[model samples]
Target: MGDETTHIEQAGPTELRDPLVRTEIKRAAVWIGMTLAVLAVIVLAQPLLLILGGLVFASILDGGTRLLGRVLPIGRGWRLAIVTLAAVAFIVGTIWLAGVQLSGQAAAFSATVTAQANSMLAWAGTHGFTPGEVQMDQIGQQLMGGLGRLTSAVSSALGAITSLFMIMIIGLFIAVEPRLYERGVAWMLPLRSRDRFYRTTSRMGYTLRRLMAGRLIGMAVEGVGTWFLLWLGGVPMAALLGLLTGILAFLPNIGAIISGVLIILVGFSAGVDAGLWAIAVYVIVQMVDGYLIVPYVARKTVDLAPALVLGAQLLFGALFGILGLALADPIIAMAKAALQQNADERSGGKAAAEP
Candidate 1:
């Protein structure tokens, strides 16, 4: 018995294995596994990005179904089918109408862009801010090189028709049965937590719907308004620029800057007066969106922080290209909602009181 007691003393505390050593080992293993998983995701980011794109489309369809239900008294299936058909028809009509004009103006657009760039360079030279044609040449080379890289990256990852088909199919399936997927996810959670999970998902859906509505309204307003004003102002490539602006408008801050720059540049290519008119048109369109459309939509949904959205855009853009950048705001909004719910739960629903 004395020997056994001595042996026990020498053995020390195996209890530490359960409370400390085992826990530490488990933690280390989890961290390592997470790191590997993240690395794998980064490597396979293209497919993941495609999946995310499908989710965005699904959200749009889901939102449309809900909206149509309010007015049409139709089943989800009929509503979804109607919305999808209408969307397809709209796209086809737009393309058919613009196809000839866009093709014809393509060369003129390129020439105008080049002229504006050279003019900008010359202006910079006159201001003593540029070293003349050498700097201009360098800038052109850099721009071309960057574009080449971007094109290569995009083509390599998403050039396949198969990818687009896959994305569309995924989105169609998800939209067809959003509730099934939502319930499945909730079912995976503990029974006590499932309500919270469902609530979070519903909140996220509402937020996304509002966000997308705002985006679509902004895009339509900007595109139509810009096209009309630019055409009236006799700016070259009015249709193309307007279409570009409308699509880019979906990206918020960065989109505005890009569209503004393109408009100003193309406007300048025509004349100084045209440039001023383009600026005026831009200001008017943006003012209307800012004061009217955005406020109305924001009242219905969560207002995202500009910096957070921009950061997500940059990070996602680097990882997954244009699709990531385009979807960044919605993704961030959804994530923010989820995180807020988690925080509220962790704080015993007292987080709502703190600030």
Candidate 2:
């Protein structure tokens, strides 16, 4: 043993024992770790997205609970319970009251949309825009085929009651005692990073709450306003259109374009006047949301650029499907908040160092 120790001492430090080499090794490890992280995210995209969906849901519940606290003077648990129960009741009541009617309208709406598409194609052909009958038939077939595939995929995945139930359960567990999870995550981080992590998470949570508040409010206003106005104007499937519009509102730019197309198509089926009226309603609702709700939300939260959000939506949707599309806004907002906080810290550090 003494001879071995003597031999080791005489042999001197190895590469890993050298300080510079150790530092380089650490740097390489970091790069490797980052590469692995990226790979993991790609491979586990679906489960990660589901977890994110749960977090988003928790943010909504947390926001509602806080809002109720201002008025109800109740315990957090009680407030959360109230909010959850209210949401469940609203969903159940809406379905119970209008399920059959809406189902019938949905089928009719699909037929109406197809008929309108054929009518448009026919009109275009008459105007000498496309004279080939075979081409028109092919185009129509392709459009219908794409729509069928999209509808089937969405119904099978996004409409899965089990997925939604799992999300709600996850959200409730997190919302019940969020700090526990927050601290648990922080515990996994290095001591020096925990404070920064906490700050970033706090900012993210605040941004999410404000962003969701605006989105929910906008959805309610647009849905109800569209329904009431369209119904008053004798538009068929007003309820279904309004419902679609409200849900789509959650998706920002893409949602608006889709809902508008549906509204215009359905509106024209009734008459030219009704079609024009639908356009007017769409304009008014959008104007209210864009000028009012968006600006108010921007002031309180991170104001994401439209193009950036759209790009993120497209990327996420393509990568992770519908849930990613629905979540792109919130994810972008949280990322923005974290980045902004990091910038602030760096600026502050520079300022401190300058003196």
Candidate 3:
């Protein structure tokens, strides 16, 4: 027993001092640290969402600058200036044209939404799923409480406006000096990994640009088509519904579902005919987007799995609310590209270049 004890004593120090054991301990430490870091970031997800919004805005500006560059024989700075001015003009014009109509419809839209809610409650009561007034009140309270929490986490309206300003400023800075940020990131990595980091980032940028383009095209088409069809059908709140459709289009599959529900509810508030017409419009818009627009965009961008995107949206929405849900697909796409590159590296293969 004494001999065994002595042997273990000797082996313990030896193992501690051994280079391989030390290396493994260091590796374990690194993994643990990395895991904690990731958890910390997830906990602070709101600020991360803000940063992500900035990056998305930067990508949009950069994309516009690039397009303008191809068309005009001008310097990049000049092209970016032109593109920025045009974007501002377009936004102002849109608001000027639609603002009054949307405002006028706002109260009616709210009334319709409330009526739809009451109808849903009535149907539930008929089906023997009725809740007492107290229970309904509690549910409403809980929902408002949840939304209040989300608002606090994301900041209030003024805070949101400030965030928008910050995002635009950050985006502008990034667009103006993209290489500076890229190099700054690369500088943080080990010298040996810098080349790989740059390559991965470049691929990610290309993927992001294409993804944004596809999304913008889809939003425009969906918004315009829905508005035209709803107007022809004389659907109530057509302008508001159209606006929601456009904004929500940014969120891909999940957004479309929510917008469709809203449109149907508003349409039904008018009449059965209007409801049917709205349904037809919804189906037609989705069909065109699915069969034509999305396919063409998918060819340019990475094809995300519907299930994966939906899952990510749910998870992100739960964790980070609306902003998280909106950006979920892009986050997933970037992750997919990075993971694919890593897998290729492990297999001693090269990742395919972006189209």
How well does candidate 3 match the true structure in TM-score terms? 0.85
| Ten-residue stretch with the least lDDT total in model 2 | 146-155
List of clashing residue pairs for candidate 1: none
Model 1, span 256-338: residue lDDT tens? 88899889988887788999999998899889987898788777766776788888887777666666777788889789767
Candidate lDDT (C-alpha), each: 0.78, 0.83, 0.80
* Residue-level lDDT tens digits of model 2 in 161-276: 55677778888899999999999999999999998888888888988989999999999999999999999999999999998898789999989998998899999999999999
Angstrom error of the Cα, residue 289, model 2: value is: 0.8
lDDT of 3 by residue, 163-243 (tens): 666777787888888999999988889999997787787777787888898888899999989989999999987878888
Q: What is the alpha-carbon lDDT for the whole of candidate 1?
A: 0.78
For candidate 2, the TM-score is 0.85
